[model samples]
Target chain A: MRKKPIPGLSLLLAVLLVAEGCAPRIPGLERTSTTEAAAVRADDEDTWLKAHYRDGRVAIFDSWQVLQRTVEGDGVLLGADRDTLAVGPFVVPLDSFVLFETDRLTPGRSAPGLAVMTVVIGVVGFLCALNPKACFGSCPTFYAGGDGDEHLVAEGFSSSVTPTLEATDLDALWRVRPVDGVVVLQMKNEALETHAIRHADLLAVPRGPGERVLADGAGAFRAVSGLNPPAAGIAAEGDIAELLRAPDAKERTSLADSFDLATREVIDLRFDAPATGDLGLVVRSRQSLMSTYLFYHALSLLGAEAGSCLALLERGGMGGAQSLLQPSEALGFIEVQLPDGAGGWRTVGEVGETGPLALNVHLLPLPAGCDASRVRLRLTKGHWRLDWVALATLGEAREAVRLPPSAALRDGFDDPETLDTLRDPDHVLAALPGDAVSLVYELPPGDGDWELFLEARGWYLEWMRQEWLGSPDLAAASRLLGDPAGSLRRLAPAYKSVESGMEEIFWGSRYVRAAR
Target chain B: MSARRASIAAAAAALVLGGCAGAPGPRGYLSTAPEVVHTARGGWVKVVRSSADATFGSQLVVEGELLAAGADTLHVLTGTGPLTVVRAPRDRVTLVGLHNRAGERALASLGLSILSLSNGWYSVITMPLNWLVGIVESHTQSRVGVLEIRDGPWDACRTHARFPQGMPPGLDPQRLTLHWYWPSAPRGFSTPR
Candidate 1:
């Protein structure tokens, strides 16, 4: 039996052959025969040259390579040694001699050639589709959530989500979610732990009654002259003024004029607490100078309780001097001073170490039937630097003080349409009292990929003063007003970790169609 | 051969021929006996010479005015104010011009198109055949121009080499290619021919 010829193959072959046959010719010069050359020479110079040679006729040579130059001097027929051809400085040996040329019809653009190039491009595209790994290496995977929201677990480029609640269930509620803020939950089981709950969790707790400030150490307080005068009068804006001195021998003594804290050195501050109801005091304190290795200091709150003198002493140590310190290590203890009825001070109830100054709140509960009036924080056991103190009825104040708005915390996207309406920057700012402020936002979902971008702005007051003490440049004037550059660099990152913690929160995912 | 084999053979041959047609030839060469060499009285010309090891040898061609020509040597004024002397033997050194015919170019282009279609369905059968033929018959020839000597005395040659009117004085004229009737020439001497 005879084998059959493939008709499709034959058709394709014929088509290619015809296409090649119809290809456009490239324009170039052609050599004329001797007779034709004679005829050309007989004609007028212009006509003959135009008809026979191209306008751009110049000699080009190929030695080991092609070297081209124009004909200048008239021919003088020299030595015919088959070894080399010397034209001015150039020497062309006969052995390597290839060829020389004038104008030649080089290939011009061809329609057929273009079609072939297109086919080549198509083939490349097909090959690329075959090896998908080359086209889409390690494409990101996304999981759709139960709410129909896409969640990207891993493998996608995106900005990080600030976790509101990572683990555990909290029944308490907050007006505004703290960026790097935490909530202390005193469980019914007598267990106390800090929790980073979501805004939803904070809403679960019932709102408390209105609150009023009973006593604020940052308020107007008269300083006594018997001991070393500690710097008073709002040293750090929004914070109570207290002595801040480096650990120097001359400054450590009670008699020294610049004593930061000394034994028996007392500061008389007057505050009106609730007369007859259950009341609590919140004390905000940090080490005078933020130092890494510092001696342990004890603070005693002395106040009149039911017509008697009372003193509550609390001792604590400062942790790492670095910019980022834990709340427990950075904050001092809060003491509730009550009267012992024999003209002596007695401790009624006391709260453990508070959070960092301007970060966490320290609460102290007053005794029943106590007449809240004058209070003093004296250096009892060790040295201490005080920030401020405030009193409120226990469980009465539900919300913290509303703080001023700061531009650093504002989101870049100011458009109300895309803004996360649930976030309130003012509420979070009011909770912490200090010269420095931190603003955090829960980035909206589906704003493309998330990337870590931190921008901080603030200036250091000490550095500014030093500049002023030196030559007094314009920068000093700006620093006096407020320089955010220094503070931004120091605080933004610390606060981000505080707010986000270490847990990863995935937001949305996207689906992309595979290439055919 | 069987019918199927014959058909396959014909297709293979077509592919081979179609692929080899567009190969280009050598760029240029020098000639000893040129048939027609036409140079205007004061025209610009370039000469190229071939050397051994075609890739390594240096072949330099001079471009300048026809200053002076003798029986064994020709002195030409260069563009940079230097005079270059070239030794020429009768019917020994000539400038070759090159050109490609239209027909040959068309064929070559067609061949290229076919070879580029190597990814097509029929390419499985035609690719090897086209490659083989392409290797054998790729190059296309270029036309060559023969340099002819002008019959004139050395003094007359110098007179012919004078810078045209309005040409800047002391400006090297050899760098320019002299053409007939250059539009940018001085008003009176527009047609150098």
Candidate 2:
């Protein structure tokens, strides 16, 4: 088929459409799209926008058409009829513009009403950009209304872990060590008391802050962190008997001035009024009991009624001494006795208390090489107070470390053996051999007469008590008679008694034995 | 008034117009093939002999024999020298040809192709916008007789029909299979079985 072209009418219509600004109909939508139309409008607005965007710079605007805004370096550019606006980096919509301005197309003269609206919009835009609520039409994301910029801030010293000092027993020696930042005091029990140095409550010297003081009343003390010696001195001021002596030189030095002479190892001496005029004590010899030697002496208290008392004193030794006893040694043996020829003896007067009697004893000097730093005294008779005023010098061979006599006399009335023996009618002290002492007393044939005899070696001390002196044969018979009960009753008028003397020695050693 | 004068005038006008209207001959149009090529090293197809009667607008339907042992590949004879390979979708074989846009549209709109049926093979109706006559020469057995792209209800001018119903011989509809290939693939397209 041949088609004829009728171009005149179509060409005329196309020209009319182009001139009228009616675009060609696109395939889909007949009307012009707003996107395409926006491009057309941009042509005129681009000059205003170009100054802001030529190098990809940006000017923030409050409204679609106003130019008022804070300008930044790069942003998206939007154009409307007669104006162009630059929106900053955000993606806010055109309707939400808060602060904007009108950039006048004519440089000098701004559009009067539009320019005012632009400035108004510009203020709003800047506020809205800075403050989201103005632009976003909602409260700022979280908390917004604070003045400028401020916030809340958190607010307490940790407690200390100090340790308390406890009182300790001070009877023994102690040593101190600081190990691993802790101070430890060790005792003989071989246990260590560790104190954390940092955690302990620090005790400082009065003036020195570095020095630490710890007083555990147990005689333990320490100084930490500095060189400060502990205060050392004896706390008590009285004399104490050292029974178990320390071998240490330091302990000896401590005891030297602290103990009295009687408390050191030495023999004791005492003196009393002699019972007869011109009486004297004699030392016959010195002998050894073990390794130690002692001086011996025979002592006599003289009086017309003293023979009976002196015999009792010999009986107090359980037997008289073998040799003359030293007066210093004989001081402890004070008793009176009456003897029977049958080798029995009886105590008559107050032998330990105030008897005129005498006996023998030996004085033992402190042994050679013996550490006589401690001494303990014990008495078997009366309140034996001995006062020593003599100061002696030590010898190369042997030295008598003399001590004041501690006088004690015990009355042995409570002793059942002695008491029963005294009460028995048939009991008799049998005759001893020629060499042994006869500890015996015989009663007289008649009443009220008694005698006691004490024999040892070749020495004899005999006491005869006679109330039958007017009858010659009766008096001679009384010389060989002894009844312990009758003799005690017969001599009860005497001031010193044997029973009281033994009680003193028995009670005096109670403390000494316990401590030993 | 004279025959010689009229011929001479006509000759002169032709000469003048030839110089003015001699637009440059259309440069040979090079295009990416619609069906991507997948070729083994030696596989090729060429126009061994072309009809002198064929003109520029003449339609061509060339289906090279593909005896693929393991996989199928295509070779398009470029007419320059060698054959160019193309890829085809799995389960569907491709035929490369040339046709006008109106012809392709007519086939797409009407669901028929005289050329495809002339050889007794089914030819696919491609997009009307495509100028190439390349067709998917396979029919999906599952979705048969259904018009995939149809004209609006009752508009005969916008013909509506199923793709690839009628075809020429040697390409059976049962033997041929339509397989969807991802469009962007440069090689034979295949979907997981």
Candidate 3:
């Protein structure tokens, strides 16, 4: 349909360009009287100006006419002998000076114009040709509107695949920074799934400067300090101490065992044991696309009957089917252990966080009496990607205040139902496909800094895929549900064939990056 | 490079863009397929084959029967003489589309839509508006589909390759075909039982 372009769109674009092109200018570059300019002599010291003289010679001055009636500047001759007449510092009487000026530059208006135009055009193009808002999402994908754009901080209850399986998932809103004591956390159901959200709130804890509120594996939040990076980290691939030394995105991920998706890989870490108080092993990591593969493949196996199957699970008709953890049961958590002096190892605790959109920070605080000389992490070979690992001096354990949405907006209009559903335990905010609800919360006033953890409680049912209907592998689904380990091994060859493209099809959806 | 060059480039761009999208061709007619099947070769890629720099390596929606997709390169069978295989950089190939019946029904649907004026002058807006809406909605839905891998590790699309395991492998791609190197693959999804 070749409809004529709307004049309103052009006007909107023009306004955007104008807004972008308008940048704040440096003060005092205005037109001023000679007396006023003379008064600001100190300011002129930084301003470079070209002085034209009555004589054929030219001079550039930093301190224009500093002395009574003359100025000292680099003497430049513009005649044929200009190159030969060495340029040097010389003084010229103000009487001989013809002009006093500084080169003026108009900021590149086109650059801003092009940028605004590109953004405007890109947005229009996306709206017309792409559905960025309908991309990959599971559970309640939270967006704390920070840094001008919506920054994805946490995804709540990502592991909960159905209503009966719903669990409370905690995620540190590390990237979120409250503005004027307010944080607007946007909850969006961007995937083709029905998300039943019961509680959407923030856990706020006070912390001092240079201190972070980290979650311990035992579900305790603590303001930890003295972050000590591991001295050495030895993985199956090789040494990865350098990668684990910082919370940089440069991660260490290993290849999956072609046969068993649950194959464990160990990374032995050596940390300089702190002399005094208790410590916690902090691990920064995110899940690999393996879970996404299992989930999607399970859906495919369920095939055309997936919708009905999921509906059945929702109604509690499928017995304990809603408790389906599948491949994750074999590979979900990361085990942390300490080397027993007698060459044996003692299990300390396990750190588990789901979703691949953002990296999670998990602190496995060792028991007070346990030794922390050496630590070994046992996790599924390719299931987890580590960004950083450190031992922190555990400070005071703090409780977070849950702040629910002060106001809620679904898409754009005020949604009282979402607010009610989130607050009332009996009712659930069942978000359907393409639903974007912004939850605005005002951080409680008080303190130097606050650490926020997103407390999202919900479960979602993935919509049936039309493509999967072509070949319904119900037997595969049953095996996946019944015997995960064997099924994962048998399905390895097929999964490997299409593994590389799975992330693109799963998490790389425009919906994940959709504007709030 | 220069003012004159920029203006000429802009003019050429407008001229080329002007030729794309109209009442009947590849625009406002098609809706999302009720069902779509992956044809191997990088999920049925539909690249805009172009030679101009202004296009940034995109132009017309060329023949979308992707032959073989690797990590770096994409081989698409252009429907030219002898069905020449047009090789493009995987990164440069932006569009990926499924070969739905949109091509077959597009002309007929469009022709009938033109006569949809029997509904009165209101047909002017409704006919094209509905068609364009369908196009937009379809593309958006396709974005999250399994085969819509515009941002790719391209290796998986190779599953759809004529030689799924690439041209060389010990019977790669899990598909059995022979050609000295390997046997020819069967036309449709023939997953080894």
lDDT scores of the candidates, listed in order: 0.28, 0.21, 0.58
Model 3: CA > 4 A from native: A1-135, A146-148, A273-275, A311-319, A411-413, A503-516, B1-193
Ranking by DockQ: 1, 3, 2
lDDT score of model 2? 0.21
Residue-level lDDT of model 3, residues A82-137, one tens digit each, is 12244567676666654443422222112232233334333333332222212344
Q: What share of the true interface contacts does candidate 3 keep?
A: 0.00
* Error at B62, model 2, angstroms: 99
Interface RMSD of each: 17.8, 44.2, 30.0
Candidate 2, residue A364: Cα displacement in angstroms equals 3.8
- Tell me how far the alpha carbon of residue A379 in candidate 3 is from the true structure, in angstroms, after superposition: 0.8
TM-score of predicted chain A against the true chain A, for each candidate: 0.25, 0.15, 0.69
- Evaluated with lDDT, which candidate comes out highest? 3
Q: What lDDT is reached at residue B30 by model 2? A: 11
- lDDT for model 3 comes to 0.58
Residue B49 of model 1: what lDDT?
Answer: 42
Decoy 1 TM-score against native: 0.22
Task: Please give the C-alpha DockQ score of model 3.
Answer: 0.01
How much of the true A–B contact set does each candidate keep?
0.03, 0.00, 0.00
Give DockQ: model 1: 0.02
TM-score of each: 0.22, 0.12, 0.54
The sequence of per-residue lDDT tens digits that candidate 1 reaches over residues A17-72 is 65455645443333322212223222221111211112111222211122242222
